[model samples]
Target: MICVGIDLAAEPAATAVARLDADGTTLRLRDLHLGADDDAIVAAAAGADGVGIDCAFGWPAAFVEFVSAHAAGRMPETAPTGKDGRRPLAYRRTDVEVQRRTGRWPLSVSTDRLGLTAMRCAVLLDRFARAGEHVDRAGSGRFVEVYPAASLRIWGLLEPRYKVDPDARAATLDRVLAAAAPIGTTASQRELMVRSADAFDALIAALATIAHRRGRTHPVPGHLGEIAAAEGWIALPDGGLAEVLRG
Candidate 1:
């Protein structure tokens, strides 16, 4: 199986994509692209069994509803006045569940700068749909939302300051390599991961895609199914890297 991972940025210059080929036992890093544009990302994902994107697929459902109601000049009767009361508008159900399981909150796509990247993701999803690959934001189709940091935490490969510190990134890469013994990477590829946090995250996103494909990630709770489908769910790995790569 082939899995493609994208570390999407608000613009093409900072985006990164990684492709992995898994043969049921060993997985090889077939390609890695830095400074990827939308077309390049679409090409990288073409024909892949699963495409994992490290970006929110959609904003919080409540946020969307609120914005729509305000635009239509029909505001709700009650308004949330405080952060606590407005929490539902800022964070999705999946985001809340991820925090519950991992004790760390993923960025709020509804309120944070990450929303810009998610806008780009929205365009990409539309492009895929036009191309006949309709992606399910709830993660039932070829494309799925993935959080690299959350997956790293679940797999026990997370390193402190890895995103900003080179030494920490190198250490994190070493730990990931040790955990995923079946993963094959060239020396230059390893160096790329050490030098660029985006590249490192793209690789982890690919691994997380494998875990999702193999049913190793936590599923959306039955109660939150409708909300998750509308708000987009984050696929968090439930097992270690070794188990994820075993496929």
Candidate 2:
């Protein structure tokens, strides 16, 4: 099976894509690309069994509703009372759940700068829809939303300060590779991962996609199913990295 992972940025210059192929019980890094544009991402994902993207699929439903109401001059009579009351507008259900599980909040697509990147993701999703793929933000379909840091945390491979510290990032990569033994990577790929956090995240996104495909990640609770379908679910691994490699 082939799975593609994309670390999407607000623009093409910072985007990265990783293509992973699984054969029997072995996995290989078939291709890695930096500065990947939308067309390149689509090409990378073509014919793959699953495509995992490190970007929010959509904004919080309440946020969208609020924006629409404000645009139409029909704002709510009362403002949200406090942080707790405003959270539903700023953070999606999945984001809240991820924070509950990992004790760290993923970027708020509805309120953070990550929304810029999410706009790009929105276009990509539309492209997939145009190609006849049924997009399911809850991750019931081929294209699933992924959070690399959350996935790593759930799998016990996350390293503190890895995102901004080179040494920590390298250590995190080493731990991930060691945990998922029998996965093949060229020396240059390892070098790139150590040098580019985006590349490393793309690889992790692919692995998490593999876990999702194999039923190794937590499922959306039935109670939140409708909200998740609208807000997009983050696929958090429920097992160690080795379990993802098991055939």
All models: lDDT?
A: 0.90, 0.90
lDDT of 1 at 120: 96
Superposed model 2: Cα runs more than 4 Å off: none
Give the per-residue Cα lDDT of candidate 2 at 118. Answer: 95
Candidate 1 Cα lDDT to native: 0.90
Tens digits of per-residue lDDT for model 1, 1-247: 9999999999987899999998886889999878999999989998899999999988888898899999999997896669898998989999998999899888899888898899999999999999898779999999999999999898888999999998999999999988887688999998899999999999999989988998888898888888888889999998788876776
TM-score of 2: 0.97
- Report the Cα lDDT for candidate 2: 0.90
RMSD of 2: 1.0
Clashing pairs in 1: none
Models 1 onward score TM values of 0.97, 0.97
Give the Å shift of residue 11 in candidate 2: 0.7
Off by over 4 Å in 1: none
